[model samples]
Target: MARYLLKRLALMVPTLLGILLLSFAVIQFVPGGPVEQLVYQLKGRGSGGEAAGGGSSGALYQGNKGLDPERLAQIRKDYGFDQPAPQRFWLMLKRYARFDLGESYYHHQSVTSLIVSKLPVSISLGVWTFLLTYLVAVPLGVAKAVRHGSRFDAVSTLILMLGYAIPGFVLGVVLLVLFGGGSFWQLFPLRGLTSDGWAQLSMLGKVTDYLWHLVLPVTAMVAGSFATVTVLTKNSMLEEIRKQYVLTARAKGLSETRIRYRHIFRNALIPLLTGFPEAFIGAFFTGSLLIETLFSLDGLGLLSYESVIRRDYPVVLGALFLFSIIGLVTKLLSDLCYALADPRLRFEGAPA
Candidate 1:
């Protein structure tokens, strides 16, 4: 097992390098640079002289002429934006060797520091959503499977299907309208991490306040993922119920509940475990993009969206790389989990 894990870990380096190269190439070839994005933002803010008509185009050109040309060149040189694509690629590769992810042009902050600061919020949201998804989904799925063809099963199936069909953003909007639209019906807060005066609370009060703010965003994020887990669990349990071991266990005078829970449910969960990593990682990053945006949560997804619009290559690349690494590692962990859960997967000379 250790050897298998080490081998998988070793393969990640090349895979990550390939991803970096492809990402870098795409970013480099995309229209507009960081400077263009800066200029566009400045113009939008009514700061650009040309946009504001504070100076004629020729005067602006002459003003640029008076600017220190060497300093301008040095800025480009320092960023490697002046270098050719091939040269810049090599420079980036060299920097990667030193674990330097570069700096954000817009924020003027180290990419690492920026991501680190934002990561906790995303992780906090993801963790809560994941917990809620599994806690609700697994039991609901088991109930549906056990009571198959009953009214309970039918209603649950219908609800799960509807949840799956609806987009997360639409769901978020519906939730917002229902809970946050009116003063009388307002059960949930609309935005931000906490209500005003939260900081003045006692420690327990602070914790309660934090949880109160988390409820809406976490609910919005969990809905789609919960549906997915429910469906998968229901299907897996249904299949496990039909298997011969379940019947044999019942025939051996096992209690109905024991046969279902101990024999069937345990085996049924193996397939779900195979998807656990994908579900967790997807929930952590991809699942909450729309929900986060709708709720105005400052998460990695929100940051990445803003970075892309601003053409912040360093921020975009850094976030993408971090997400990719997480996904790869999760996949690796899932494989190990499969081996641990199923004896068939543990054979030393097993076929690849």
Candidate 2:
């Protein structure tokens, strides 16, 4: 097992490098540079002033009249923007090798620090949303499978279809209208992490307030996840129910519940387990985007969106790198899960 795990871990290096290369190449080829974005922002702040540093803007001429060209050239050199693309790529690799992810031009912060600050909020949201989704989905799926084409199954199928069909942002909007703008507006807070007086409250009160603020965003996130999980669960269970082992259990006069839960459910869970890692990685990265934006939660997704709009390449690349690492690790974990769940999946010559 250790040897197999080591092999898998070793394979991940090349996969990660490929992902990094692709991401870097795409970013490098994309039009617009960090300098342009900075200039645009500065110009905007200057109230529709001419482009800074040059172009048709008279502002550049006025601003640079007293500044030395040599000093400006030194400034650009210090920032490494004077280097050719190949040199920059080499420097990026060297920095990555040393675990130095560089700095964000827009935020004037280390890439690591910016991601670290925002990650907790995204993680907190992902955890609660995933928990809610599985808590409702798994049992409901089992019940539906057991009932087959009955009313309970029919109703669940309808709800699952509707949930899957509706985009999270659309659901968020509908929820905001019903619970945040209409008659029930005061029932749930529209946005943010906590209420105004939350910090002044008792510990339990603070926890309750935080949970209250989480309701809408969590609900929006769970809707689609729950629908997908339910469909997968129901299908897996349905297949397991028809297997020969289940027939054998029934022939032995075992209780229906015992055969279903003990045998079928356990087998069904293996397939579900295979999905957990990918599902979690997806939820961690993509799920929070729409939900966070709609609810105004400041997380990695919102941060990435703002960075993209402003052409903040450092933040965009940093976030993509983080997500890529996560995806690779998640896939590795899924492979480990597969080996654990099925003896047949054990690596050739692997230790027992």
Candidate 3:
């Protein structure tokens, strides 16, 4: 197992490099990026601060027309844009060897600091969503499976299907309208991680305030992400319960309760357990995006979206690399779960 893990960890270096190279090639070669925007801003500022006339196009033209070759070259040199793409990539990798992620283009903050400052918020949101998803879905799925063909099962199936089909962004909007401050019940806070005067609150008060603000965003995330998992667990359980092992247990005079819960459910858990890592990754990365954006949660997804629009390459690439590493690590976790779920299966060097 140690050797297997070492091998997987070794493989991650190349995979991580591939991610960096791909992101670098796209962002570096792409036109109309941060450099161009900076040029336009500088150009507009060079005139009377109104970019030849007023709008963006006028500013871009004036900026381009006004800049001398020396100034252009200087600008490129200042941002390291003058270097070839390969050289820049090499420099970034070398910086990482010293544990630096460089600085954000616009913010002038270290990319590592930016991500670290925001990590707690993102992790809090992610952890809550991950816990709620598995805790609620597994039991609900089991019940639905056990009550299959009944009205409860049919109604739940329909509801879960509706949830699965609705886009998360659309669901977020609906949630905000109905539960947030809008035409309906203003039961939950509209946006943000805390209320005003949060810093002055007592410990319990602070905790309460924090949870109060989390209500809308977390609800949106859980509602958006749970349906598919629930349906999957239900289907897997139902399939397993009908298999010959279950029938054999029944024929052996085992009680129906023990046969279902002890034998059938235990085996049924294998498939779902294997998917745990994927579910966690989705909950943290993709699932959080639309929800956080809609509800104004200051999570990594929101930061990533903002950085992309602002063309903060350092932050963008930093976030990308971090997420890639997380995905690779989660895949390793899934492999571990696989061995735990089915003891017969083992890694190449795992002890018997």
Best by TM-score: 3
For model 2, the local distance difference test gives 0.76
**Residue-wise C-alpha lDDT for candidate 2, range 263-285, written one tens digit per residue:** 89988888889878887777666
- Sort order, lDDT high to low: 3, 2, 1
Give the alpha carbon lDDT tens digit for every residue of 1-352 in model 1.
6777788899999998899889888876554455433333433533232232332233334344445667556656756678888888777677766768789876889888998877777877877888888999999989888888999988878887787787777877887888886533688888767779998999999888888888877876676776778878888899998888888888889999888888788888998888788777876676466777787778788888778766677888777777788889999878877876677785356665
lDDT, candidate 3, 1-352, per-residue tens: 7889999999999999988898888875444555566786775554222222344445345567868878877877877888888899999989876768889987789998988877767877887888988899888898999999999999988887787777767877887899887788988888778888999999999999898887777766777567867887788889998899988888899998898789878888988888789777766565477777787767777788778766678899887877788899999999899889888886895566
What is candidate 1's CA lDDT for residue 115?
84
Model 3 bad stretches (over 4 Å): 45-62, 285-287, 349-352
Stretches of candidate 1 above 4 Å error?
39-72
Q: Total clashes, candidate 2?
A: 0
Q: Please tell me which model should have the higher TM-score, number 1 or number 3.
A: 3
What lDDT would each prediction earn against the true structure?
A: 0.75, 0.76, 0.79
Query: What's the true lDDT of residue 262 in model 2?
Result: 87
